[model samples]
Target: MAHHRTFDLLSRLPKVDLHLHLDGSVKPETLLELALHQGIDLPVYDREGLIPHMRVGEECGSLIEYLSKFHFTTRIMQSGEALERIAYEVVQQSAEHNCKYVEVRFAPQLHRNNGLTVEETIHHVVEGMKRGQRDFGVRGGVIAICMRNHSCQSNLEVIEAAAQFVGKGVVAVDLAGDEAAYPPEFFREVFAESTRLGIPVTIHAGEAAGAVNVYEAVTNLGAVRIGHGVRLKENRSILEMVKERRIPLEMCPISNIQTKAVSSWEAYPIREYLEQGLLVTINTDNPSVSGTDITNEYRVLSDRFGFTAPELVKLIMNGVDAAFLDEADKLLLRREMENEISSLGVSL
Candidate 1:
């Protein structure tokens, strides 16, 4: 009964997802159906069989192994329609969970293996998200990702394609992939191009690597937010830098646990960071990949960390503040969210 009430309250709260990946959030059922429709070959023939292979187990070895799951999902997402369906479903799912805004990201270079142009890939995803917004009232934005493992030239090409959609539907540009293998310093010039065009930047850092990576992401790549920045807790200087600059850490607790990003749930740093008055936001870094959602993320925070309605409200509002929306949109969201949350017995 308590769990049900908690879920009901959580569903009623307005939310924002800052670090969702399009290719990483495809549903298992949808994956099987899409595979059949596209005539793509799969190792497993059924959803149950495919799920165990797709979703990483609780003891995922390393960040590289954790990311390899995308190979299967991205292979099937090369077609324009597949990209559209994935983006559309992402928005629909976010809306169903009461997420008022979201920033969905994907690496265009990953989808071009099947011969589709990068612009076409971005166009299809934006089209699907726009359709979802029109139907479900969930405001959506895209973030073009440049993989760390890919060639610099290819990443530059992705930047050019992403810059074209700066104000159209794409919200920001991001760097993703094996952070430990490819440092943020390598993409210095690429991120400079994004900065020159006034495009916001976010980087996947302090997850597979260390605080040095987080430092480079902000100092070199000009990142406004850090994705899965759970490791930022280890270094005091990095923590101070984040707090001083007010850089938001997009924290995905379950995903971190599954990837062994942190040793255990007891050692999670989000609550500690919050207690220190740092800017932090809760996110489902990869819903389907992590087999979790924004609501479940909140439930874990509540049940495991003893977060109350007020504390949960603060985290949700952090997402609002950290969103890639413009000032006017942010103001509108703040007012709307405040009204809704306060009515639900959340105090400010």
Candidate 2:
């Protein structure tokens, strides 16, 4: 049996985060500052007053309610400077937590209401992420989001913008937004274009909907990864298929509990899925929105599910395996992680 590891050791462990949202992870203080700087209106002017409206955990009623917070965040993230700052802050935070590599994602179209084109949004975001990499020495990548609730025409623009930055820094494309109302079928053609452009795909599914949505995302949209796939455990056949295919599931415990996707941390299927030999990678779907971070996420898995140091190592390895990085980069990351662990007197 595996024994639990101390939080201090976990904190020192090198990590990979593949499913963080930029719009959802902006710091409260930063949000307030941006609102004032951008001349954007906000119901609250200070961090203490704004945190309640921004951080939604168990109080979050549903996915829609959790997502509603984006309205305030997106308002401040419209300009190039705002986007750059948020991107830099996200990577900086990840670096502080010992995350060696991270993939930050957001829908470019959401920022276009302020007169920025989708391309401009992607450019600024990539620039910011690059700046963070230089400053923190923590490598980062961008994943342009194609919102499901938006029209195919709108998603097409996002896909085109993503294609323009494939090797530059945009590593992959993803589908996000209301999962139940807008199925993967709606974005099939857009994902196809992304595939043709050699961009890997991940889709938000099985969170607000059923396992069939997960199936559709994999079969129709070519999603190599699934976000918030908490519901996939409900169907054994689908679970078995996912296991057989080695499809990685980006499971966010606190976010799921806050969104009411799962009842609580104890009820989350993370341990069960791991026991069943599924490739489950822990993540923070929306850190600020859920009032959590990568370290807190690992702590939850340890306290709630009894994930020991070895199991935690496996979880991080799962993220490394699922990253959208190139083969050479992946190999280099693996070596670095191994060396980091050896220096800390730990082993896989």
Candidate 3:
């Protein structure tokens, strides 16, 4: 059995985060400051107005409504300076949470409404991320996300932009957005292009949709990692396929509950996935919106599901193994984690 204090200490352990959204993790205070700098009036400024919108309560009826809150966030991230600042702040915050490595994803198409070219959009974010790494001493990378609802041709352009940034900090390509209407098959060509270029792919599936989406994402879209694959619980066969293939599921418990994918933390399928031998990695899809962090997510799993320290170490190892980093980097990170755990005198 894992001691509670050990679990609390594990929360402080440096781990790799494989599924965090750079835009979604914006700090509320930073958002307010950015809004003020841009002279934009946001309805929720302080913690009082922000807490209600952040928590998972009766007010958030569905995933769609919960996601609608991004409108306020996107409003302030219109300029190059704003994007750079937010990106830096995101990496800094991740480091504060003891995240040694992170691959932050964001849809460049969403930032184009403010007159920034797609290439320039990626450039600004990459610049910010590089700066964050230099200043914070936390290594980070960018995953370009194409919105699912957009046209396939538009997504190809996003992929092309990402391809151009290859070897320049853009590590992977992902498909994200409303999953209900836009099926995974719609962007097969874009994913094919990513595969052809040897770029890894992750798709948002089994969240708003069901197991069918997960199947299509793997079979048709070539998603090596499935984002928010909570709906895998709906189909046993698909879950087996995931386990057999060793495909990673980036599970976000608080985000799922906030989006009504699950009713509460106790109802989450994380333990089930772990017990079944599926490659599961914990994440905070949107820390600000979900009002949680990597530590809080780990704490919830510990308190609610009785996850032992060894089990928690397995979960962290899963993330480090499943990350998009190169072989050398992965080996270094693995050794670092092992050394830290060994120093703590916790036997696995």
RMSD per prediction, one decimal? 1.2, 1.9, 2.0
Worst window of 10 by summed lDDT in candidate 2:
1-10
lDDT of each: 0.89, 0.89, 0.84
Off by over 4 Å in 2: 1-5
Give the runs in model 1 whose Cα sits over 4 Å from its true position. Answer: none
Per-residue alpha-carbon lDDT of candidate 1 for residues 229-324, written as tens digits (9 for 90 to 100): 888888999889989999999888888898778888998888899999888899998888888899889988999998989899999999999999
Tens digit of per-residue lDDT, candidate 3, span 89-125: 8889888888888888888888887799888888888
lDDT of 3 at 178: 82
TM-score of 1: 0.97
* Per-residue lDDT value at 217 in model 2: 88
Q: Model 3 segments beyond 4 Å from truth?
A: 1-4, 44-59
Candidate 1 clash figure, as a count = 0
What would you estimate as the lDDT of candidate 3? 0.84
Query: Would you estimate the TM-scores of all the predictions?
Result: 0.97, 0.97, 0.94
**lDDT tens per residue, model 2, 143-165:** 99998888889998999889999
